[model samples]
Target: MAVRVDLNLSLDGIAMPANQTAENPMGEDWGRLVAAYVGTKTMRERVLRDTTGEGTTGVDDRYAAAYFDGVGAEIMGAAMFGLHSFPDDPDWRGWWGEEPPFGYPVLVLTHQQRRTIDFANGTRFEFLSVSPQEALDQALRLAGGADVRIGGGVGTVRDFLTAGLVDRLHVAVSPIVLGQGTSLWDDLRSFDLGYAVTSELSEAGVNHVTFAR
Candidate 1:
């Protein structure tokens, strides 16, 4: 099975906002970076679970739809799972409400041990303190022959990339620039040298870039 990473980052390669507070979990820069993806009709239907058919339907929507394709299981960091800001809040589910978009199993990587959470939908979250390889092994087992997606908050993606565990990676580079934030390419110099790279400019102005090995 293929291990893929799909992410949205600023023009400066910042994946997460520098100042993320409880009031603004994704931070102020998050809106600008993911505006295009969030505005797509596919995101509205899938993530928002809206049947209103109220969103843009074009190149941006096509990329947004592709994001969820072939993804049977997901592995994400605690921050991506919304545990960084609300560590003590046991009732905190995640940024996504009751019914999350990811209908597949999700493995959350965290230092602290916690019980597994299963939603009414097919979304099952299991917390693990293991290394990237260990977590990927568990995720692969649950993936059911489909590809496992590396859903990230920057650090998680970097860890997988550094360990050479990712086979395909797609990054939507927004036109905005975040002067300060957690960067995805911090120590990843020449990381794309071995991968076949391609880029396409979406109608919303974001560059849809992909790296496949």
Candidate 2:
């Protein structure tokens, strides 16, 4: 099983946009960063649960479809799970709705202890207070030989990338420049030396870049 990561970055390589608040947990420029991905048919139907038959069905949609292709389990950071936004609230489920798109086990890396939450759609949120490798071990077991995804908000992805645990890295480079934010390539100098890389530009101006080992 492979460990994969899919992220949206700006032209400046800002994966996590700045100006974050409780009202907008994803940050102010988040929409612009992921505009192309969210506009795809697969994202509309899958994540948004929109069945209107709308949304683009081009190259961006294909990548969006592949985002959920073989992911058996997910490991994400606290921010990705909305813990940083709603830490005090005991009832805060997550940014995802009642039936999250993930129909598999998901591990949230957070220090704040919480009980495991199971959804009816086979999606289980198990909070973990462990290292990146430890979390990956648990996710691998839960994956049952299927591919494990390193879903991120920034820090989590960097941890896995720094540890050289990721097998596939795909980033949708949106044509926007956010002056301030955490970049995906921060401290990752010469990170592409070992991987075979390819790039394709979508109709929506998103450059889909993939680094595969």
Which one is best on TM-score?
2
Show the colliding residue pairs in model 2. none
- Write candidate 1's Cα lDDT for 1-213 as tens digits: 899998898999999888777788888878888899999999989988889999999878888988889888999999889888889988778888889889999999999788888889889888999999999999999999999999997899999999999999999999998999999998899999979999999888889999999
Estimate the TM-score for candidate 1: 0.96
Put down candidate 2 lDDT per residue, 1-213, tens digits, no spaces.
999999999999999988888788778999988888899899999999899989999999999999999989999999889888778988778888889899999999999999998889999999989999999999999999999999997899999999999999999998889989999998999999979999999998899999999
Runs with alpha carbons beyond 4 Å of true place in candidate 1? none
Q: Model 2 compared with the native: what TM-score? A: 0.98
| C-alpha RMSD of each candidate structure in angstroms | 1.1, 0.8
Against the unseen true structure, what C-alpha lDDT does each candidate score? Answer: 0.90, 0.93
